[model samples]
Target: MFQGWNALLASVWGCCLIGFTWGQLSDSPDVLRNWCLDSDYHKPQPGPEPQLFSECSPWKERSCCNATVSKLIHHNVKVWHGFQFRHCPPQVSSECLRFFRRDFCFYECSPNLGPWVEFEYARKSRQQRFRNVPLCASECEAWFHACKDDLTCVRNWGSEFDWIEGTNRCPENAKCQLIRDTYADAKDFCETVWDNDFKYTPDNEPCMVLSFDPSSGNPNDNVTEAAISRHMNSINSMLNRQRIMERSFSCRISPSIAVSRGIPKLVCDFSFREFDKMRQLKGKPKETPRQKKERKQDFSPENQHKALRVALPIFVGFWVLIGIFIYLNTRPKH
Candidate 1:
């Protein structure tokens, strides 16, 4: 009776454990899909800095195993807010600039305003591949004329604001329309905003003189200039980062190819290869049916002996328990 009871308990436990394992194996596909979706679909964020190459130089176009290359390729990096406004190609309507201004400007552009920019992803393929396309110059000009004096247009234009409230305050329909349509309108606004002031501002302007005076040996002036230089460099770095992000999102698989068009030296020479190596270290390859069978057969002979070596102690303990139970039951009345 004791032997039978011990056998029944072992059998029940074994059956339940096997069933659970099989259920998990069958649901593997769903698990994998969920995992991929979680890991791949979201906005890319800044990751750990890649290994830097000492041999690489900014002036010289050469390749080294820098981790920044992968981040740039994947568009998982950040830059200065001011970089977007730099190097505007006159009369050329840039889709990159347009999209960048529309979506990212509120966060990165002006600090004084609130969120008011109304932007949507362009559906057309030509617009998506916007390089230096022509924009609505006439509409842009007309809109700029009306809003040139309005505080919101001049001060809070590129910054941020409530769309409904701000639009209502605009003096003219054209001003509201251009401001809402950010791409071409933004370019025209930026161009004309400072145009009138540039000619009137004399060389001896107090603010300009203190900042640009070469002979000023004052320590404060030197410090200010150095700070300005660093700020400019940061903006330049952000510009490069922006280019890579745009290209990566635009062409997910082969972003390097698209980005390399403008930046000849930034060809992803080793980033992908390094990324693959990193993946292989962390990722396991799925086994084929034949491979699974081979793995199962590995339990024969020496493997069986190895298994017995481990199971022998557990088996001994089980029989000891059964023997004690039988002894306890059969003992004389006490």
Candidate 2:
């Protein structure tokens, strides 16, 4: 009876363990499953995988990156040059603006395959950045096509589409130098680079970041300009601690902007080439080659002669008047 009872307990425990294992296996996320099938479907080779996956070449014509990018572009972007700023007031702090740009790019530009996909692909390879070149190229190409129709989008592509290094073609990664903050060094001069979390902007800090919850499969679902505006406005008010710049933007989405309450003080210290591009957009048009040639021609002998002709009579009249005045003074004095 003792031997039979012990055997029965062992059998029941074995069944429960097997059932739990099966449940876990069946519960894999769709994104992870899709990535495995798409990215890792191929058989392993003896050597390292190629930096550029030529197998994905067939996907070039298919806008694979479109779904990922449009998550932000479709809603956050207004007609070409504008953003869904109904949530963000013009008086909002610059920190909120940096947050807006960073959040948009982080979600949109990130490799659609999965997180750390770039790092994984490049781990065994010498050129890590080149590991997912094909995918990167495809994303850039898709953005180029999407923005081609809008002048403001095209012009601001440097900041707007800077994820793929602002071009469809493979570009050399720019090396960035970390500026040593004198204020920081005053506390302690450490030889090792400090892991300064505070130095990072809110978008860079995941704890402070507010990402758009993209609905599954359907990029358009729950994504609207009004929704995006409402979201941004809420974030802006939370960060605008001083209340000096906490006015909300007006839009049909939210008729009255409410002041954010009890949010942690957040600072915006981020700058992008895109901001400069926007400033340039507002500034004077660039001088074209034709304009430069015309300007050069204006200084030519022929043009100089025409200008001199107009000025010679005035110059001569002024000298004559001066001479007459001198003569009159001398004669009167005599």
Candidate 3:
């Protein structure tokens, strides 16, 4: 009777174990089947064998088995994370916050930031200056005269007259002369008389004159009215100051003017012989007569024909040999 009781207890335990495994497999049949077929599942099959947990299951034994669980949890957490919740830390100190907030930080937080602040400031400053005092043609003329009084004014002064007229007014130290002509003539005159260090003034016509030198003492001795008039007529002929605020306004605003004029053209007289000598020393090498003749000979039709004749037979024989070998091998291998 004790043996019978022992058998019954054993059978009951075995039944319970089998029922538990069946329930587990039913709960996750796909995972279980994949686990069974998995290369790492090394238990012997087709016999009475113990069931094992899948790597994807909570009961898995190896740490590597936990990878799927970790991945799932990470994906769930990431889905809930929001971008707006991420805020930048404040960069300015508390002491500087008042001034910085009033003047600087507003720009820092902007999407595009303050890229054009300096340019805007400069434009505003210019606008304010223009509002305070405006420039006029008369003012521009006054500025011109003031420039003449200074020993250093040459091409820097405004040019308002043709070469002849300017010569009459410019200081003697300024080598003012006029040359009547077209642009080409003016260029030639400049090269001839002024050694190319000169400028041109034309109300609407061509004229040329030496550039004034301010550093030299009184130019009147060397300059003559005839020279000025002659050059002016030769080219085409033509002729033709500031303040501050009250006390600050009382200050003499410096005179300023914009002068646009053409500079002189100097003569470039180079000899062909000298140019040729330079080419001989520094230019690229030239092909020799013999090399040129040889190149022509190599490309002649007879040579091409000779080369083709030598190559054709050899190429034909190689292919014929290959074809024969293929036929012999592929013939039914009895």
Best by lDDT: 1
The alpha-carbon deviation from the true structure for residue 311 of candidate 1, after best TM-score superposition, in angstroms, is: 5.0
Runs in model 1 deviating more than 4 A are: 1-277, 285-294, 300-317, 329-333
Per residue, candidate 1 scores C-alpha lDDT tens digits across 173-251 of 3232233344345454533332221111222321111111113322222222433344446545654544443333334
Candidate 3, position 260, lDDT:
14
Give the clashing pairs for model 2.
Answer: 87-233
Which lDDT tens digits does candidate 3 get at residues 1-334? 3234435545665575455333122223223222221112122121121121221122222112233333332333221112110011222223322221211111111111111111112221111100111112232232233222222212312222123421313334554322132112432322222122223233233221111122352121122232334433532311100000111111111111101111111101122233334446877646768999999998889988898899999999999999999999899987
Deviating ranges (above 4 Å) for candidate 2: 1-281
Better model by TM-score, 1 or 2?
A: 1
* TM-scores, each model vs. reference: 0.21, 0.20, 0.15
Which scores greater on TM-score, model 1 or model 3?
1
lDDT for model 2 comes to 0.31
Query: Across residues 140-181, which tens digit of lDDT does each residue of candidate 2 receive?
Result: 232233322222211122222233322221123522221122
What lDDT score belongs to each candidate, Candidate 1 first?
Answer: 0.33, 0.31, 0.28
The TM-score, computed over Cα atoms with residue i paired to residue i, of candidate 1 is 0.21
What TM-score does structure 2 among the candidates reach? 0.20
**In model 2, which range of ten residues has the least summed lDDT?**
189-198
